[model samples]
Target: MCSPFTSLSSPTKAPSLEVVDLWFRYPRSSEWVLRGVSLRLYPGEVALIVGASGSGKTTLLRSITSVGRWIYGGELRGRVLLGGIPLEDLPLDGVRRSIQVVNQNPYTHFIEHLVGRDLLSAAVHLYGKELGRRVFARITTALKLEGLLGRRFFELSGGQLRRVAVAKALLWDPKVLVLDEPLMWLDDEGVADVVEAVRVARSLGKAVLIFEHRFARLLHLADSVYLLRGGILHSVEQDFVKKVQRSLRLSRHPQGGSGGRTTGRPLLLAEDLWFRYDKQGDWILRSLSLEVVEGVATVVYGTNGSGKSTLLKILSGYLKPSRGRLELRSRAVYVPQNVYLFFTEESVAKEFEVACRSRNLGRLCVERGVSYLRALGVDVDLEESPFNLSWGQAVRLAVAVATAASEGPAVLLLDEPFTGLTYLERLQLAESLVKLGNTYVITTSNSENLALVPSARVFKLVEGSLE
Candidate 1:
């Protein structure tokens, strides 16, 4: 079989990027995250790096951009060459002009509150006002971001944020582009838009490197695929997707239905629900009504910016309905899309202890917490800081903490909980949710996640109404 990393023919032009015998570790850390990793990306090619969470994919990207040395406070020993010149020897301004990176967290790139100003600021800073406007106009039209320019950054949905981040990076017209989890937070249509943007970049002879957990959707567009594991990189065949599929298969537990009491009546009810962020603003949800029964899983599905998250917030009592009636039989533990917001404790164990203490389940806290973490397939050290966990691990930890808080029967609301998770991680989460046997209300844009609860009452949210 041909290696995915092998180029069709040696390019006449110099390679856009070259990593030779790279080795790196975080400050004061004895273990190296990347060891002797080497790769070459020529102009007009799209390369993909796939790995499980915490497998150093993000670390490799940071190393290429020299962010590890300056911002992340990491020690590095190796050479990163760009355009036939070593990165350390290149001027800072020259490096910045030649390479543009879009981070995994889009929120970190926002400098202006409004979308148009945020995008314009970067363009103007780089190319000056007159030329920047032309560049912004061209890129926004290409990415179909014209409609979002007038909105506030906070008002944009997850998919919109991802698009804007890509557009911002492309507006600079760098020689190399790096995107971390670019396909995340996007719906099917949004994914197509990003894929097209990548194609356009390659057509312009720019090198592109993407770090993604879900690469099946982008496989056809990638010129090469590399798997990062145990601080090493290896080329893998496209057929490796079969392995990912097998990992995603849901497990059938013998005791799955034994604990669930599905005969109970509805625990939460919504009638004539209507909501909007502002009085004059467009209604996000209108005349939406639903019933959630105990021991039953419920999924709300919609496209990007379709108010799925908004509905979850309303159901969880975080946002008041402008006009509606809502009845809850018990308290709810709501976990937002950004799970980090719910964390207050320094460490995972402490967070679990606090949750147990709040519910007066003192003696059982440690035992229950460890059990929950195991169920979620989280193997991180309990003493490690919660912030230190990767995105996928942190999300699983948040779910475990939320479940622990609901000592008795309660409603568990999770918004986009499967954002950064791998296929196996998601499968583990599904099994854990089934065992919990609580009334679960999950909102997601991914159709794949709907299968997590086969028996879930699925509802589609369209144009402010549920169907």
Candidate 2:
């Protein structure tokens, strides 16, 4: 066995991206999110930072990218170097010229409504207009984003949005590329596209640093793997990926309902469902039909842009189908992929109280919500703002708020509910859903969803129709 950080001492080579004794915490926070973290990424190499949800992986990226300092106004200590130059010494624009970042939420990366215009504008702003167009064309083609060029940014699927963000980052052609959860929300094809993009970046001698929990897809691309836990960075051999995957495997719960779906009276039914954002746009849900039965979990599996979310939105009454017959017997509450949309109240306690009160469940139900949040590993302060919670914590909190009502069984429409959750957290959620006595329709692009809820009735959404 050899030290994973041995390359840091190599005398002849300088790291393209380097962090030395870095420490950071949010403003007015006593707990340090990152403590003495040190790592070096060399040109032509891919470095991976792995951690569970809320383990400060995003915070680490923020620190490395200087967002934690200037924008976030956090207490920071330690140095981050780009091309052997201290990041503090470099102007913000100078740093941006060398480093490009793709955020975990792809929507935050775009400013324009049209995908093509956003990419072209960003590239032109970074480079000259003439050179930017050429770069945009090359990057878009490489990422297979030609079809998405004319599409509205918000209408793109999560996977498509991620691909566009990657292409946008590549347009900068910076010395270092930083991606946060780049593989998330992607189907097999989209995953391959992003993987290839990272490979190409490495081939072009660009240093790449990826923060991801989905190690299975990107482990092979990593030149070094570091685990971030409890504000500390620990080097782990890439072989540990197998152990990580194994740990993520769920032990079959006696209540688990995946392969053997129990069917009862149909709670919701859709016939010949058709939907699109606009009349001229392509149909997202083309003649799609679905039947969700009472007292059983329904899983809709599809690629990122396969209209799964669209279907969920329709079922939840957030959107109406362009043409279809829909009969929803029970009330449907939707928890979107972006869990932040679920939070309307300022504090966690207030949100819980309002949700419970809406169903006449009283303050007791609010206490139950807090207990439920703790069971899901959130343990958030009731007075704290829900917006401050981590993505995983927010998911747990939102689901708790949605289901804490005592007003009988309702249809739970969860869009990628397991997205940001750890394996244990997901397992807890799946088990909770099984016992909640609610009809649930969970949409996801990951096959692991089937394993998590074996009793779920699975439907494959392909080319806009359920198969």
Tell me, by TM-score, which candidate is best: 1
**In model 1, what is the error at residue 194, expressed in angstroms?**
2.4
- For each candidate in the order shown, give its overall lDDT on alpha carbons: 0.80, 0.80
Q: Across residues 5-94, which tens digit of lDDT does each residue of candidate 1 receive?
A: 222224548788999999999998999999999999988989988898778998898898888888889998889998888989878887
For model 2 the TM-score comes to 0.75
Please report how far candidate 1 places residue 31 from its true position, in Å: 3.8
Clashing pairs in 1: none
- lDDT comparing candidate 2 with the true structure: 0.80
lDDT of 2 by residue, 1-467 (tens): 22211211223367889899999999999999999999998888899888886678888888877888899999889989988989888898878867889887889888889999999998888668897777777677666788999999878766677778877777766678898888776776767767877876776567899988766667778888898998899999756766755544543222454333355888788999999999899999998888888887888888877898889999989899999899988778999899899889989999988888888788789888788777666776789999998776787788778877645667889899887665666777777666556688998887665678776777789899887
